[model samples]
Target: MEAPAYQRIAATFRGRIATGVLRPGDQLPTEHDLADQFGVARQTVRAGLGVLVGEGLIVARRPRGYFVREREHMVYRPQEKSRPRPAVPEMDRFSEQIAATGRTPSYSIEVALIEAGADLAERLRLDPSATVVARRRVRYINGEPTNINDSHFPIDLVRDSEIMLPAYLARGTDRVLAELGYAQHRAIDEIFVRMPTPDEVHRLGLGPGTPVAVHFDTGYTESGRPVQCAVNVLPGDRHRIVFERHWS
Candidate 1:
């Protein structure tokens, strides 16, 4: 039996995209044009285009037409946090990584005192309703929003510290905590792959077929007291999460 008309139509464009015959921002032939070329109804052409849209291969612009999607992926390593930061005091780990790749990294931060929700409370070993300091940052690369990093710390542990102020800390929070006698000796990182929440979709400006990887990093002091919990949101289409292992 012959393949469905829509599949054949979709395959034609998919092949063209794969071969770079159709580059990003290149608009596809209109539904009427495709229907005429394939000798099919307009609905069939729409169904075919729908497949590409659902696959993140293309996007539809109502007033104009569909265009190939552009993608730029960033490498994200969870283990980087455990490594020592750059010797230069001018930049943090994120900035150092991006700068090494010739990309500029910038961020906006907001600090608030919020009631500890279930997830954060558990990670921080605090009562669910207890107050915690939330330090949120949206990292941008080349002036485009890249990822979200929102960290929560026990109020009693971080109150009045730079962690509670919405400003850049030349020395990261870890060092600040060390000065406060709660140095983190170890950390646990957990990751979950799922669809983005409505807020996340808006924050990241994500499109259809774009999922996200939610990472939770919990830090502990030498005495095993939980001191900080950070929730990092990485958009699937734009981030590649990596981990390395060693055997002793």
Candidate 2:
């Protein structure tokens, strides 16, 4: 089946942005103008604009119309053993990774705790009521929120470690894990795309009908014990996860 008209318009505008035809901060044509040009209803134009806004490609101001936004590119490097992994500083690794690629990184920690839960148990390979540390964070690039991460760690493994402390007072989880004697030697990652949940829609500032990519990462020690499980949700339009494989 053919794609919807609103999607076509969104694609067309996205192409323009990608090609630099519509530079950052450039105001998009009025809704009526876009509707006339695309021979679609104003609602269609609004929907297309909403897609761009949700993707962090544009911003809308009351009585001012939509304007193109500055875009940031993300770099992804697979977790490697031979390759040197830096100590996790006192901040979210997701933000650190984004900043390393020349984009400003920002995020908010929603929850952090040592608790017992079914989700943590399943991922940690422990009993259903086993205690674990849970953390939730929302990451932003530039000024737009882009990713949500929920992480779990076995309590006995990191209860006294720095990862449990505030970012300012402690080193990050990766560094803390190294210090706790469970240095991560490798990681397994799973990626899938789907529509946003109601909570995700509000948390990620997504508009109606936007899909997101979910990444589940499991980190392990050299001894093959699972140390961390993280679930990351990224907006489909704002970020793309790249995987590179090299054979020995």
Candidate 3:
């Protein structure tokens, strides 16, 4: 079947942007001009352009035409999960990464003891409704809220420890876990792409077209017992997951 005129128009512009023919902040032709080119009405041109807008590929500036969006991403490497950190360093891994990249990092954290619902219970190998300690943080970079990192541990595992504190841990929580004889031996990474919930949209300050990437990082002890499960919610426009490998 033949596709609609709006879809073809969107594809034409999408190809141009992907190939770098149209760079960021470059303006698209006027709607009248695009209508004349596509042999369609102005409304049809608007519809085609709207598709790109919703995809976060372009922005519409009133009085002016639409332009390609200026996109920037925070590089996230999954390998950092099992990577080691300083013995008694200044900040957590996220803080270190952002500062290393020459950006200021900060966080607002809170700790709560909650019943491990299905989502967390299954990952931590605990019964549903089991008590657990939840450490939640809204991580910010250069003063902008960037992502959400919430770590969960069985209550019995982290009770009366620094992990139950809400202050910044220069030694980091992982080290505290190690002191408790639950050092992480392995980890699993799970990624999910979906639309943002209302609370997430409010907290992340997301725009109308924004989606999110939910990264579930679960860590286990050498004895094969689950020790930690961290839920990291990253905005689609704000992060890029990266991996590097070499052939031996």
Kindly provide the TM-score of model 2 when superposed on the true structure, using C-alpha atoms.
Answer: 0.68
In angstroms, the error of model 3 at 137 is 1.2
Writing each residue's lDDT as its tens digit, candidate 3 over 179-203 gives 9999989998999999999999988
Which portions of model 1 miss their true places by more than 4 Å?
Answer: 1-4, 11-27, 61-64, 86-88
Candidate 2 residue lDDT tens string, 1-248: 97898999899889999999999889999999999998999999999888988776787876989888754445444353225545544444565666777878776764466555675566668887777777777777887788787778888898876656544323456666787898888787888789889999899887544688888788888888889988888876567577667998
* Full candidate order by lDDT, most accurate first: 3, 1, 2
Residue 179 deviation, candidate 1, in Å?
1.1
Better of 2 and 3 by lDDT: 3
> Model 2 clash pairs?
89-172
Report the C-alpha displacement of residue 5, candidate 2, in angstroms. 9.6
In model 2, which regions exceed 4 Å deviation? 1-29, 33-62, 66-71, 78-82, 86-104, 114-119, 169-171
lDDT of 3: 0.90
For model 1, how does the per-residue alpha-carbon lDDT over 1-248 read when each residue is reduced to its tens digit? 98999999889999999999999889999998999999999999999999989888999999799999887778899788778775547878888789999988999999988999899888888899999999999999999889999998889998778788899887788888989999888999999999999999888888887889999999999899999999999998888888888998
Model 3 Cα shift for residue 23 (angstroms)? 0.8
Higher TM-score: candidate 1 or 2? 1
TM-score of each: 0.88, 0.68, 0.86
Question: Which is the leading candidate under TM-score?
Answer: 1
Global Cα lDDT for candidate 1:
0.90
